[model samples]
Target: MNVLLGLSASNGIGIGKAFVVPESEKRVISSKKIKAEDKPKQLERFERSLAKVTGQIASQLDAVKGDKVQSEIFETYFLMLNDPEFLGDVRKSFEASNHSIEYILNQKTEDYADRLRSSGNAYLSERAEDICDIFGRVLNDLLDFHPFDIEQVPDDAVIIAKSMAPSDTVILSKRRIAGIALTDGGVSSHVGILARNYGIPAVFDIENILDEIKTDALVIVDGTSGEVIESPDGVALSYYQNKITKAKEHADKLKVFRDKPAKSADGESFQLMANIGTVDEARVAMEEGADGIGLFRTEFLFMSEANHAMGAVHSKVAAFSEENQFNAYKRVLETMRGKPVTIRTLDAGGDKIISSLDVQHSSSEEKNPLMGLRAIRLTLANPSLLRTQLRALYRASVFGNLKIMIPLVTSVEQVEEVLAFAEKVRDELKSENIPFDENVPIGVMIETAAAAMISDCLAKVSDFFSIGTNDLTQYTIGVDRENALVAPLYDEFHLAVLRLLHKTIKAAEAEGIPVSVCGEMASRTESVMVLAGMGVRTLSMSPKLITSVKELLSKMSIDELKAISSKRLNSL
Candidate 1:
């Protein structure tokens, strides 16, 4: 048996035909080169090439048939193909340089890949491989090369590629694929996220796996421990097979709790909701017994645009509403159809760059953008953009159980302003004789200290409050969670942050408005117990964590939780 040794980086395993990276010549251009007149033609060629490649991928998706995971991969590519900034950059680079399209595209891709890798942001760095992979495939498609067939790969093979794009990962169906080993990528990459979603084993950043591992090698990927054993002896093979069996058994146990209610031993029932970004995720959440979608991050629909346009923004919302109108909303409504799917409006700002915003003339380049103008503050300032999103949410409400949520609301006035704007949209729709639900519940994300402190007042006007503890803890403790330098200070267990959470939950309780926690903290086993004691009525988190949280709740008594909370609070 062919054998190769490497590390397993993700949970699932795959064995498949290897898509080796093809060699290409890198062309370089000097600034002193003549021919300014040739710029437009080069740009036109580049745009046309991109459009053609997108068309090809779409055609490929149409032809392939397997599973949702595979379909998502193709859909992600379609989104990238239509990305305004991606295409616009290609055009800009071509116009400014006197290099061949191949040279320019490769150079740009490499530069971006390097920047992402070096930036220390796992998500951005992982996406770098995707950028290169997508561009390379697009270029190859332009050159009349047929991409690999998804249906023909052997059922139990691991796919070894130089790198993988988000689109490439999306197109793969989970049933056929087992594990993934890549020469490039990291934990935060698109491939990594996709792998996790698919529940497949993956190992990334193994720089030379493509050159070392032979095709059809019998490799065992251990995702939990990040190990890869190649061409194992019978003893080792038996060991892995037994390990996989045990893991499956554990997963099966979790699945048993999928349909059970999340209730504390003392009989306090709380909604276990899911935080989702797309329609595909909506399906998964419903399958996993999520009460409702707590955070429907609408930003994914807007991020493709380098310059956020009102018309484009409206269309994206319309499309999301239209495509998902029947199923996405219907699933939540049917599951708890009459209950609420609290959709948080776009929280754009900080590190999330809105391509259309003019940042050159801003007062100061924010030294720390994450804590800067973001969420409701940024949205309120951009009235037109905010209005477009509000209109979409208002329109979507007619289809099923929907609620409007404003992110990062610090004051009563900000909440009132958003409510007023939402009312305007509802009135306009009514005037137009458009079908909609005018009385959709409005809520606020209590993420900042100001928002949490005055949550009682805000709760009076709003229907509910979702505690965004991720930001709350970050701001409360004055520590950036992403900054390793002060990571130890980023503890959610800090008495100040816990007390603030308790205060916010109590405030919402006093006002008779339901409260929930929708952050990383809500998903933690230990944190769930604390939140229960704090009187949180809901816990919204990643769907994968739902079963465990529910199981944990089933084992714990509310009285015990309250006792712990009382002791913790007294110590403070």
Candidate 2:
């Protein structure tokens, strides 16, 4: 038995035969010159390949089922497939250099991929692989290369790969994949998010994994410990078999709590909601018995509209249309089916910064975006963006129980300004005799020390308060959660962060306004218990964590949780 250490991208345990998914070999294109007459034929080939790849993605969008993240990953790929800039670049290269279709596409993909690879933004750089995946398909089409058929992968096989793109995850979800092992990929990557959402055991950064293990070899994937065991025998195999049995038993026990309320042993009932980014997630949350949606991040709708908006200078229209925005909001609201849905307006910044949504409509090449223009600051600075979003939210409000919340709001004046602007948009809709919910509740996120301090004032003007513990901890303690060097110092259990949460919740309680903690902290058992002890009854997190949190809540009394929280915090 050989134990290989890797980083856990998702948590679970699985035992299955290894299935090595080999990467598609790139075909060599002719680097030779072409005649002017051949240029037209070569350009035609490019367009045909584009249409073929576009159809492939469209088929996946229709065929893929159950997973929301899978659809989103493909949607991003769809946007890339139709990108006018990408098409124009290929055309220019083909006409100028008189190169073959294969050469032009290969060059264009590599060139754009290089820029994204060197962009320094993980969100952008990680997307470079998706670019490679997209163009790889088209290039394969032009060269008649047989791409890897993921559908034929044996069901219940542990997939090992050198690298896995977001689209690859979409393909995996279509099959009965047991687990995942990657030679090189980050846990913060989009595929990682998909893995967790789908509850697949996954590990990454296992160099030369295919060489270490053979196809059909039995493997044990311990996502909890980030260990992969190859060809286990006797005692080792018995131990893992027992481990898998216990996991199954625990999961079965948890299933019994699915329909139960998230209440402490003493019967202190609480609302457990899900933090979703898409309408499909909303469906899953409802399936998991979620009370409502704690946070619906709207930025996922405009993730890369900047592609066209940035290219508009040459010749392309921005994809930031209000109708598209309204549809996204309407779908989620309708999916929730009268359940409370708290939608956070675009909180794009740091790795999430999209320049097309920017006030100046500029590229996001900032040295430091986390502390710079972002969230409500970006929206407030650009009234047009805010108004567009406000109009969409209002239009969608009539479909369900909608609650609009502002993100990164630090000042009372900012709250006032947002409220005033929302009202103005509401008035415009009314003047036009547009249909909408007239009394939608407006709220603000308490995510900064300043916001926590002035929570009393903000709570008075706001209808409700939701604490974004993730950023609140980051800003209050001066630790960037994304920076690996300083991330170790980023402790959510720190006394300072606890103090801020305590202050914020206390302020909200004084004003008789409901407050929910809609952050990562709400997902963990101990942290959820601690926050509940802090008088936070409404907790929002991933839909996958709903049952686990309920199980933990069922085991302990509210008084015991309060005691544990008090003792734990005083020790700090």
Best by lDDT: 2
**Measured by TM-score, how close is model 1 to the native structure?**
0.75
Clashes of each: 25, 0
Give all candidates' CA lDDT scores: 0.68, 0.81
Q: Which ten residues in a row have the lowest lDDT in candidate 1?
A: 306-315
lDDT of 2: 0.81
Runs in model 2 lying further than 4 Å from the true structure: 23-38, 93-104, 147-152, 301-338, 353-364, 369-373, 381-385, 395-400, 432-438, 453-457, 476-489
lDDT of 1 by residue, 22-76 (tens): 3233423334443788766766766687778777766656654334435444544
**Ten contiguous residues minimizing lDDT sum, candidate 2:** 306-315
